[model samples]
Target: AEVPVNWCPELGTVLANEEVIDGKSERGGFPVYRRPMKQWMLKITAYADRLLEDLDMLDWPDNVKEMQRNWIGKSEGAEVDFQVADMPDAAIRVYTTRPDTLFGCTYVVLAPEHPLVASLTTPDQEAAVTAYVEAAASKSDLERTETKSKTGVPTGALAVNPVSGERVPIWVADYVLGGYGTGAIMAVPGHDVRDHEFALKYHLPIVQVIAAAGDDSWDIQQEAFTETADTVVVNSESDLVSLNGMSAPDAKEKITA
Candidate 1:
């Protein structure tokens, strides 16, 4: 919500997010920089549950109702904490549906517009991260996703995996939307298409943790095989817990339990 709006220094008017296009005002074509502004904000998340429950009362079509449900975004996932490296006191929290794949996570990606971007970027990586953040600020969520290339800049910061205690690099990518999920994600490149693409582009490791039935091809370089309830878990090795050889449903239940 902090993207730069069309503002006229001469007219002394502040426009809305919809009023600006291509870094210019729609009406005047005056140059506008995507800048952040301080303003009163509403706590809309407090009403999310209520809004989602009320959708059933609307006399709309099934598709329309489903669309509204998605808009509310009532996702169920564990909010795991990842401690930022070097910044002992700082951390980033991410919500993930597949907590069972924590071992497969090779890296973590944060939306360029994520609030923690500025604080997480190290001194050596500041200039590149700043420019990337600025470019992201100017792009709309849809425009950002339109680019086919899986582009991202490392934050020069690392995060400690909660389960494995392993260190992984943190990155800023336009693919991760600031408003979706938690504005951050544990990148399991082995089972996610988007994550696989990003990892391949950056030469990051890809570890397969889910074994598909009759599908011996666990090679991530070929394609990412999304696990479902029927797939069995594998390579989930950790002192805390292990889901190897367990069905996807069983693994999720055991891990979350």
Candidate 2:
């Protein structure tokens, strides 16, 4: 929740990351910490899918329409409920656009504002989680969404990966907004950039479950396999569902079933 910023005391202004050339403000060469504040926003995300679907009807140029499509950022995925480990009554519901990679889930993330945050956090993490949630309170919805830096605190509790049967740690982060999707996400570090960043920072696991249709060049240590055009599942199999070697779409549908 505590975002980094280039705060320049000489200029008395918080400069943007790009504006700070070599740790100093570009204009005055003032020393700054890349941090600051800003505005309000409305929840227009509920209509993102509708907006993207109707984009073709617009008379705008292809480039502008493409931009609009990117802005909408609508993802088609499934909602999965990961039951809490050792806690029968608690579960965290997550919406993922890549359910086929369920076997690769290294951890789970919950929004700081999630209702189960306080209850799910173990006694050991109470102080740190409280500080994090309190710090996150200052962030606006827009800020939280746009924040690229990942910050989180472990709940000390784990979630049973529904498909893989792996006990993955649960974390609370501001980036996962309480109102977004299901306020939680199955963190598949091997397939998601943001999740990968967090995993690397925290020394968590990164398991690859997808690869190019015919290529086996993916290296989990380097980066996540985000391309799905002709990708197939790899290193993803369980007694309940064996998605290995299937195309992304087929694998998704099969797993979701």
The best candidate in terms of TM-score: 1
Top-scoring candidate (lDDT): 2
Give the alpha carbon lDDT tens digit for every residue of 102-186 in model 1: 8888899999878899998999999999999887766655556777887899999999987777899999998787766678999
RMSD of each: 3.0, 6.8
Residue range 1-257, candidate 2, lDDT tens digits? 33334456788765544575544567976655423244244667788878888999999999999999987887788889999998899999999887888999989999887889999899999999999987665555555667778889999999999988989999999888775578788999998898899999999999989888788977887897788788888988778879999998888899888
- Backbone clashes, each candidate: 0, 9
Worst 10-residue lDDT window, candidate 2: 32-41
Please, what's the RMSD in Å of model 2? Answer: 6.8
